[model samples]
Target: MEMSSKLLEKAVSEMAHLPGIGRRTALRLVLHLLRQPQGQTESLADALLEFRTQIRQCKECHNISDAACCEICSSPKRDRSMVCVVEDIRDVMAIENTGHYRGLYHVLGGKISPMEGMGPHDLTIGSLVSKVKEGEIRELIFALSATMEGDTTNFYIYRQLEGLPVKLSTIARGIPVGDELEYADEVTLGRSIVQRIPFEGSLKG
Candidate 1:
C-alpha cells in the first residue's frame, strides 16, 4: 500500500494489529476518524485511553471491571454457591446476555491448548480451586467451549477439586461439538445452561 502520510500509515498499522481487522479495513477506519471533527477523534482517543488505563480484572472472577470486583460478583442477588466456569470475558458477556444464569462466573482466561502454549498454570485455575476449597461454591458448572481444549481444561479443574464436596456439572450438549459457547444462539445457550447434566455424563458423551 502507498502511504501518503507517515501519521496515517502509523494509524493504519496500529488499527490493523487488532484481531479480524485487515490493512484495508484499518485504513477505512483511520480515514473515517480523520473525516470526523477533531473533537470527535479526540473523544474517541480519550475513551480508548481511559478504558485501557482504568480497566481492572474482577478480584473474584477475573472478569473485566472498573473496580476490584465486577458488578456480578458484587451483586447480592447472584447465586454465590453456584459458579459458572468460562474461557474468557467474552463468554461471560454471552452467558449474561442469555439471562439464564444467575450464578457468579470464574473466567479461566483461556483453555488449555498445547498448540498455543497455554497450560493450566497459564490460566486462573489456581484461584478457582481456592474458591472451591473455600466451601462456599457448592456447584461448579463447566460452561466452556465444546472443543477438546475446553474439555481438557474442565477435566483438569475437575481433578484439581477431587474429594471436594462440591457437585460438578456441565452445560448440555445442545451446543454442537467444536462450537464456542459465545457463538451459540441465546435460546440454545440458555437451554444448555438450564438443562446442564452431570460431568460424568459429559465424559461419556
Candidate 2:
C-alpha cells in the first residue's frame, strides 16, 4: 500500500493492528475519520484515551469497571452464593445479556494454554480459589468454553477446591464442544445455564 501521507500511513498501521481488521479496512476507517469534522475525531480520540486510562478491573470479579467493584458484584440482587466462572469480560457480557443468571461471576481472565504460554498463574485462578475458600460461594458454575484448555483450567481449579463443601456444576452440552461461550446464542446459553449438570460429568467426558 503506497501512502500519500505519512500520518495516514501511521493511522492505518495502528488501526490495522486491531484484531479482525485488515489494512484495507483500517485505511477505510482512517479515511472516514479524516472526512469527519476535527472535533468529531478529537471526541473519538478522547473517548478511546479515557477508556484506556480510566478503566479498571473489578476488585471482586476482575471484570472491567470504573470503580473498585463492578455493578453486578456490588448489586444487592445478585446471588453471591452462586458464582459462575468465565474466561473474560466478553464472556461476562454474553452471560449478562441472557438475563437468566442472577448469580455473581468470577472472571478467570483466560484459559490455561501451554502453547500460548498462559498457565494457571497467568489467570485470576488464585483469587477465585480464595473466594471459594471464604465459604461464601456455595455453588461454583463452570461456564468456560469446551476447549481442551478450558477443560484443563476447570479441572485445575476443581482440584484446587478438593474437599471444599462447594457444589460444582458446568453449563450443559447445549454448547458445542470447542465452541466459545461468547459465541453461543442467548437462548441456548440461557438453557445451558438453567440445565447445568454436575462438574464430575464434565471431567468424565
Candidate 3:
C-alpha cells in the first residue's frame, strides 16, 4: 500500500510483521494511532519500550515477568511438589485460566521440532531435570500439546528422569490429537489437568 508519509509506512511495515497482522490491518492500526491523542500514542510507545527493555524471565519456570521471579513462582499458595511442563508462557496462561491447576510450571520455551531445529538442549530442559533431581518436585505433569513434537519432548524428558523418584503424568486425551493446549476451551483443559494419566500409560498407545 502506498502511503504519503514514510513515518506511517515504516510504522505499518513494523506492525505488519506481527503475527496474524496483514499490511492492511497494520495500516489501519497506524492510521488509528495517528488519529488518537498524541499523549495516548506516546504512552503506548513508552509502555512497549519499557516492556521490551525491562521484561525478565522467571528464573525457576522461565515465564515472562517484570522481575527475576514471576508472581506465580513466588506465590506461597502454589503447590511446590507439582510442576506442569508447558511449551511456553502462552500455554501457561491457557492452563492458568482454567484455575484447575494449583501447582508450579516449567516453561520449555518450545517443543522439540526437528524440522525447526529445536532440540532438547536448546530448551530449559536441563534446569527442569535439575529441579527434579533436587527431589522437591513430586509429580511432573506434561502439559504440552498433543502433537508429535510435543510428545517427543515429553518422552525425552521422561527418559531423562526415568530413574528419578518423581512421578510422571500427562494431561488426559480430552484435548484432541494435534490440538494445542492454548486453543482448547477452559472446561476441556481443566478436565484434562484434573484427569491426567501416568506418563507410562500414555506411552503404551
- Residue 169, candidate 2: Cα error in Å is 0.4
Off by over 4 Å in 3: 175-205
- The deviation in Å at residue 30 for candidate 2 is 1.1
Candidates' C-alpha lDDT: 0.93, 0.93, 0.92
Please provide, for model 1 over 1-205, each residue's C-alpha lDDT reduced to its tens digit, 9 standing for 90 to 100: 9898999999999999999999999999999987888999899889999999999999999999999999999999999999999999999999999888999999999999999999999999999999999999999999998889998998999999999999999886688889998899987788788988788977762
Q: Ten-residue segment with the worst summed lDDT in candidate 1?
A: 196-205
Each prediction's TM-score against the native? 0.83, 0.84, 0.84
Residue 199 of model 3 has an lDDT of 85
Model 2 stretches with alpha carbons more than 4 Å out: 175-205
Q: How accurate is candidate 2 locally (lDDT)?
A: 0.93
